[model samples]
Target: MDQKLTLNGNPITLTGYNINGNNYFMLRDIGRAVGFSVAWNGSTRTVEIDTARPYEEEQPADSVAPTDGSRYVPQVGDTIRCPDGTDYTITDVSRWDKNAFVSGPLGELPQPTCDWSSFPEIELPAAEVRHFQLESGEYLFIRNLYETRRMQYTLQNLAGNHPDTSKDGKLAYGGKGSPAVSIKLSIPSEISAYSFWPWRESEIENLFHSCPPGTYYMEAWDVYKDGVFQRTEYNIRAV
Candidate 1:
């Protein structure tokens, strides 16, 4: 049987045999397809396999094709897009360095690292409002912007005040932490991007404990240099 195989976006062919209604593939064919080594030891009368060694064709050296330079090799700081439509920046390329190779036919290779945290900082056209749901079942509002030293935020219930029977008939207020609360944060003189979480997870959970399900308004201002830098608002739903 002829089998069509696609490895790393490249197509190849392999021969397989049907045995007892199951397709069986040769070990040598599988190793060559996956770039591994498979050899038979006549002296020991056993089969030897080496995963560290790459598969080498027995063809003449002249048959090896030269690189056309059309393929792009990723280096440190180079951003590449994955097939899944996600962009990732190369953080390290030490694995490709000649110094990483050992004195052996098959040298150990180091794996490169690509971290999302190491990606370049995002540049926003304006202040952005972000939300995170806490494990305590409360939403934490985050204000992301540039050049921020102080953050002032307010949460207002748009559905007005009401009594929450779930919390001992407590009178739920429209403005949970109103008049507006402000918090001071330290900003380095060299850094500008800032992300501020208005309230702690526990505090947010407590604030909404007695509040009923309704639409709420969240307004936040990024204050720096003794004035407001940017203001953003978001409509939140509570249940």
Candidate 2:
């Protein structure tokens, strides 16, 4: 049989046997749960327990538990075991958001970087950044996307507009009979950027209030299509 156990708010699953209608867990499993050493003495024909040492599993590579009985801190290009007993390879780490995005047998999933207790707060000039902290303890940083004047002029010229006379100053352009070209905005310093979409101030505020506690990244921009106001696009991601 299998048994589920919770120790100090951490959930652990162990194999057990049913004897006389009562569940009996293996000594090794109990040792693992309580952070102690367990071993089998072949010559002595006995089970040995060492309370002074930490628990270490002599299992397969993929299912090995932490030797020191501490939480696993994942990093890029590393394979880690999840709580569901599956292996995942981390591909990227978002330092600003403190999340490690991984792909493996279970597909893509976001895992928190639990080792970090806190991240450096973003501090930028008022002309560029806005920071918020929700009641749920999530940190959010929103910044305006800025482009150099030369880059803006070059984009205007490519879109068939007069670089000197075009007064629209749109970020996104799609002229008639021409392929639509959008400016590739750079992420702000000390922040991470993920998805980009048009969003309003009210909508952003609502999302900030509703999201769960975690670090969040966002980049805001005023996007235009053919000299007309389309929307303010936001690239948002949670760490």
| TM-score of each model, in listed order | 0.23, 0.23
Q: Model 1: C-alpha RMSD to truth?
A: 23.2
Q: List residue ranges in candidate 1 displaced over 4 A.
A: 57-239
RMSD of candidates 1 onward, in order: 23.2, 20.2
lDDT of 2 by residue, 1-239 (tens): 67888888988899989989988887877997899999765235367899999998855335222332222333444433434332333333443122233222221222232211122222322332222234643222223333122222222243323232222432222354222333333445656654433322343344434543333444444322211223334565444
Q: Could you tally the backbone clashes for each prediction?
A: 0, 2
Q: After the best TM-score superposition of candidate 1, give how far the Cα of residue 129 lies from its true spot, in angstroms.
A: 80
